[model samples]
Target chain A: MKLYNYFRSSASFRVRIALELKGLRYEYAPVHLARGDHKLPDYAAVSATALVPTLELDGGERLGQSMAIIEYLDETHPEPPLLPSDALGRARVRALAQLVSCDIHPLNNLRVLKYLVRELKVEEEAKNTWYRHWVREGLQAYERELAQLPPSTYSYGPTPSLADCCLVPQVFNGQRFNVDFSGLPRTMAAFDACMKLPAFQQAQPSNCPDNEA
Target chain B: MKLYNYFRSSASFRVRIALELKGLRYEYAPVHLARGDHKLPDYAAVSATALVPTLELDGGERLGQSMAIIEYLDETHPEPPLLPSDALGRARVRALAQLVSCDIHPLNNLRVLKYLVRELKVEEEAKNTWYRHWVREGLQAYERELAQLPPSTYSYGPTPSLADCCLVPQVFNGQRFNVDFSGLPRTMAAFDACMKLPAFQQAQPSNCPDNEA
Candidate 1:
């Protein structure tokens, strides 16, 4: 198996976390997103969306979308499941993950931020504010959901689940934009708990082979 | 089951399609997004994100996020499954769905469009251009993926799957914004096939009770 990804992409970091959690080994194939490698025809052929974190299976089949890829990994591996066995619990965890993926991360991703400056002509500070605003609003929602659930070691249970895989990456990206983490207790607690694990540490940007800073 | 949703919301429309396809009976509970019904305290109590398209079960448990809600419905009611039986096939369908949900729809959703006008002060034409741009790019990608797969009546197979559940609503929303559909053959074909179905026709915004126009 080979993973085509960028070190700093949160979506890529998500698939990395899932792989590491499952103790799966795959060759790292870096596609530099900042350098516009994703737009190149070579990488475009490898991905339909021309996005990072495309997992090519050992049989040569490729899969994209971090959430979908993570779910596939969980389904195939099945040891230390990223989602709960029950239907309702799985829905709750998936909802938490989508709260980050759909609501927050999409607004602040590199392409969207680039558009804000280059296309919309938004100022630097205002762009950063836009990034922080969505993160804060999303984390507050996450905290609210967590308040409704029984306290667990991770996002939804004693072990790391799909929600934690998403939340940790978002928090990591948020910190880079100076997103305020003051009001989000349960959200931050989940992040702190995730960071204590070796899988999360290994999958972070700084530890990636293509890390620039 | 009861669905708290707005007629024109595409995410809400996705859940409606899934429920209709599964032949599940759900009471329509409208939360008008444009009128700010989702921001009210009552809606907030029903959903942590205060977003519409929340499915409240007979047991009083509520599920947010349309994708998660659809998946939950499929899991609990297994007949006429929205996903494929194989893991790889399921992954492909989900990737196609997220290509719209996470990429195109998020960029053009009501709140993001509102933020463009209110916060960024982007002009109306530019905002519409922004909406059309993301939708076109995403649908092109959807076309590319479909071209890779075998021809089918819907997005994935002879029957409507999760990909059609997502694609139909996106195409509907994109048409309202005057998104260019000339170059996307496979994508449009799938949308056309979906529109031919009774379930898709019944779940459309115009068919909903809360539809104003």
Candidate 2:
């Protein structure tokens, strides 16, 4: 398996975490989002959508979407299942993941931020305000949900699961963008627990091949 | 089963389509978004994040997030599966679904639009421009991925799957928002095909419990 990755893309960060959690050995083919390699014809051929973190299976099937790719990995390699065994639990975990992945991350994502700054003529401070707004709203709700979880060391359970996989990255992105974590103790606590794990540490943006810093 | 829904919520629309596809009977429990019913304590008890399309199963399980509910429906129902038979195909279908669900719809969702209008002080026209811009970028890429398939009537094969479930609601939102579609022939063509189906037609917002002329 090979993953087309970009160091700072939160979506790519998600797939990397999933791969690390599953103990999957795959070559990392850095797509260099900063250099616009993802927009090039060569990379575009493999991933028609021009998105990074496209996972190419050994059988030459390419899968897009970080959630879908992570799901495929979980299904194919089920040792430490990323999803809960029960259907309802699975749904809960997915909802938690989507809270970060769907509602929060995309709002503050690099491309969307670029569009806000470049296209909409949003001032830098206003763009930062936009980013922080999503993080503040989303993290407040997330803190509430995490607080409801039976006092787990992690987001869902004691062990890292798909929810943690998503939470850690969003927290990383939130912190990276200077989103205030003052009111989100549960979220910050869970994120601290997740960061202690080898898998989480292994999947950081700095750990990726394309990362310069 | 009962569904906490809003007619114009694309997330809610996806679940309705999934329920109809599964031939599952569900009581319509509309949460009026314009009236701010979703923010009430009762509805928030059903959904922590205060989003629509929370599926309360017959077994007393409450599932939030439309994709999570759709997957749960597929897992429990099993007949005429929403996902493809193979993992790769399932990944493909899910990636396409998330391309809309995760990437597109969330950016242009009612809540986000409300945020733009209320908090950001974006004018109505600029809000529409914001909505249309994300739709065009997402659908353009959606059209690119769809072109890889055998030119089927739906987003995937002839039958409506998860991709179609997400696509129709998005198209509904797009058209309702007046997002221009002259650039996306394949998408419009596929959406047209899906809309002809009774299941899709039945799931339309105009057919929902809270829909008003």
Candidate 3:
């Protein structure tokens, strides 16, 4: 298997965490988003969306979308499940994951930020403010949901489920912009717990071969 | 079951299609997003995120996030499965679904559009352009993926999978903003096929109780 991804992409970070959690081995194939490598024809051939974190199976089947890729990995390698066994529990975990993947990360990803600046002519501070606003809002929602659920070590349970896979990366990216983390206890606690795991540590942006600074 | 949603919300429409497809009866509890009903305490008690399309089960377990809610419904009631039986097939269907759910719809949702005008001070025309741009880009990506796969009656196969549930609503929402649908033959073909179904017809925004001109 081979994974084509950017080191700093939260979506990419998500798949990487899942891979490491499953102890799956894959060749690292980096597509640097900032360098416009993802826009090249070569990368487009690998991904229809020309996005990062596309997992190519050994059989030559390629999968796109970080959430889909993570779920695929979890299904194919199910010793340590990324989702709860029960349907309702699965729904709760997935909802928490989407709180980050669908709501927060999409608004602040590299492409949308570029559009805000290049197309909308948004100033730098406003763009950062936009990023922080969505992150804060999303994490607060996440925290609220967690408060309703029974307490657990990770986002869903004693194990790191899909929700933690998503929350950790969003928190990591939000830290870059100094997004306020004071009020979001459960969300941050999940992030903190995830970082303590070897799998998450191995999958973090700083540990990637293409990491900057 | 009860669905707390607003008519014309694409995410709400996605879940509605799933319920209709599965022949599950659910109460239509409308939450007027435009009138700020979602922000009220009553709605917030039902959904931590205060987002529309929350599914309240018979046991009073409310599920948030359209994708999560649809998957939960598919799991609990699997007459017409929303996902493919195989893992790889499921991944492909999910990727197609996420193309709209995560990439396009999130960027152009009501709150994001409101943020553009209220926070960024983007003009109405510019906001509309932003809406159209993401829709076109996302659908083009969806078309490309579909082109690579074996031609099917729906987004994945003979049945309307999760992909079609997502695509039809996105195309419907795009049309409101006059998004260009030309050159997306496969994407439009799938949407056309989906519309022919009675399930899709019954779930459309115009058929909803709260739908307005």
TM-score of each: 0.99, 0.96, 0.99
Which sections of candidate 3 miss by over 4 Å? none
Error of 2 at B204 (Å): 0.8
A68-148 per-residue lDDT for model 3 (tens digits): 998998888997999999999999999999989999999999999999999999999999999999999989999999999
CA displacement after TM-score superposition, residue A174 of candidate 2 (Å):
0.8
Label model 2 with its docking quality class.
medium
lDDT for each residue of candidate 2 in A1-213, tens digit (9 for 90 to 100)? 999888888888888888988899899998888777989999989988898779998988788999999898988899789888988778878988888888898888777888777766778888888888888899898887776677878778767788888888787787887888997887888889888888889999988777887
Q: lDDT of candidate 2?
A: 0.86
Interface root mean square deviation for model 1, in Å? 0.6
**Clashing residue pairs found in predicted model 1:** none
Q: Is candidate 1 or candidate 2 better by DockQ?
A: 1
* Range of the 10 consecutive residues with the lowest summed lDDT in candidate 3 chain A: A183-192
Please list all clashing residue pairs in model 2, or write none if there are none: none
> In model 2, which runs have C-alpha deviations exceeding 4 angstroms?
none
Weakest lDDT window of 10 consecutive positions for candidate 2 chain A: A145-154
- Residue-by-residue lDDT tens digits, candidate 1, B30-94: 99999999999888889989987899999999999999999999999988999999999999999
Q: Is the docking of candidate 1 incorrect, acceptable, medium or high quality?
A: high
iRMSD, per candidate, in listed order? 0.6, 1.1, 0.6
